[model samples]
Target: MIADQPQQTRDPQAPKGRPTPKRSEAQSQRRSLANSSSKMSRKDATRRQREARRADMARQREALAGGDERYLPARDKGPVRRFARDYVDSRFFVAEFFLPLAVVILVLSMIQAGAMQTYVLLLWMLVILLIVINSVVLGIKLKRQLRKRFPDENLRGVVAYALMRTLQMRRLRLPKPQVKRGERP
Candidate 1:
């Protein structure tokens, strides 16, 4: 029977065509291949990371300034926030003038006359009160509108968000106003 089969014999000392790779060696080669696409020095890696971060920030700022919903951050995303922003933007709120009004009051308070200073203080207080009252009213209206528009939305933090947006000068609000003043939301 042994003689009937094709004669196949090998010299034990003869070299095989190629060595079989060890399991560890094969795994290491696979890992190297998988990770070999890019190789950078520490400095280059750091510089690349910084450039990426700066580009991201620039995109974010552009989105905020241009009212580009696609690139807006998580907090500014979604139709509910967009409606809230538009609602606040479409109206003229006294709080929107708070910064400039405060500056005026500060200048007035610096005047030499005691009566002028007293009047400036009163004016400052009056402006603050008006701003607070306006914010409260704006918040109430915004909440009602948001509830009507987005019944299932979480109302938490929305009032504050709308009020804060209202307090910002129209020209300075981030996610810059898409609607002009007096436009319906």
Candidate 2:
């Protein structure tokens, strides 16, 4: 038993009871070693890419922090632009709907003021018809204005967006730049 005590070996090879090396084992070992060598080099690739991105962002921020404010020529940012934004946010609603409402209110007040003008009595039907017409016109104008401002946003993942998205046929009702009466697409 004392003689069967473990023997010490410095030159460590594959451990005992491991699978016997096959004929292709040498080739596989060499290939794997080469792969691991190459892979190690690319381990820092992502870090390097992130570093580059950070550097670029830092440069841009530095430029922006300084007085290097670059303006895009086409992107108008003057008083007119501010006015347009304000109009869209508030005044557009007043113009498109409230003005018509105010007109109707004014007409009602005027008629209630006195019957001094005999034209109202004579053309009461005409006046009523005109008010209705003005209301319809105002409604249409308001709808168009709202559509232009907020826009009709289509819900995502519907049949229209998924299947026939390319065919935006809603524009057919609008006045088109028709190629002559007998022209082809």
Candidate 3:
């Protein structure tokens, strides 16, 4: 009876607790997991980067429109610059008319008459002189005002900045005028 009992067999390559997986099967599982994780992370990073860029652009536009100070560009930031901008915005300057006057003079000079040509030249010279005088007066006044308002602040480029701003048409001014014309700086 003992000799008639059936015998049991086990696979030599398999472990005691589980069957051994094929090398190809193991590699495929790892590759699938890594691909899924990397794709998700890469997509998330791209979305976050896009959001940050959009927020930055919105802030810049707001600053350009004079709506917020936090996003103002480096050149336009600071109290002194703000004051100068306000000062220039609050008044009308004769220099603002220079472009239109020059255009008119150019058209007049194009006429065939000699006398008209001479008159246009003289008019152009006169307009230039007036603009120069106006700029000088504005520079002096702006310097005094800036000194009084920001005594501790550096006045180095404030005058020049203000003068350049004055030369621009009011509507075209960047960091568009926060204060209305005739308003106190």
TM values, all candidates: 0.73, 0.20, 0.70
Give every collision pair in model 2. Answer: none
> Runs in model 1 with CA error above 4 Å?
1-44
Mark the regions of model 2 whose C-alpha exceeds 4 Å error after superposition: 1-37, 69-185
Q: What are the Cα lDDT values of the candidates?
A: 0.86, 0.41, 0.87
The residue-by-residue lDDT of candidate 1 on 1-185, one tens digit each, is 68789866665555584567789999999999867755566569899999999998999999998978888999999888888888898988888888898888888888899799889988988888888888888878888888888899887787788888987898888998999989998
Best by lDDT: 3
lDDT per residue for candidate 2 within 89-143, as digits (tens), equals 2211222343345566557657644663454454555555654565445445444
Best by TM-score: 1
* Candidate 1 TM-score versus the reference: 0.73
Backbone clashes, each candidate = 0, 0, 0
Clashing pairs in 3: none
Candidate achieving higher lDDT, 1 or 2: 1
Q: Please give the range of 10 consecutive residues that has the lowest summed lDDT in model 3.
A: 8-17
Per-residue alpha-carbon lDDT of candidate 3 for residues 1-185, written as tens digits (9 for 90 to 100): 58788765676767574687789999999999888777878899999999999999888988888647789887788999999999898988888887888788888988999799788888988988988998898899999898888899888898898889888888888889899999988
Question: Which regions of candidate 3 deviate over 4 angstroms?
Answer: 1-51
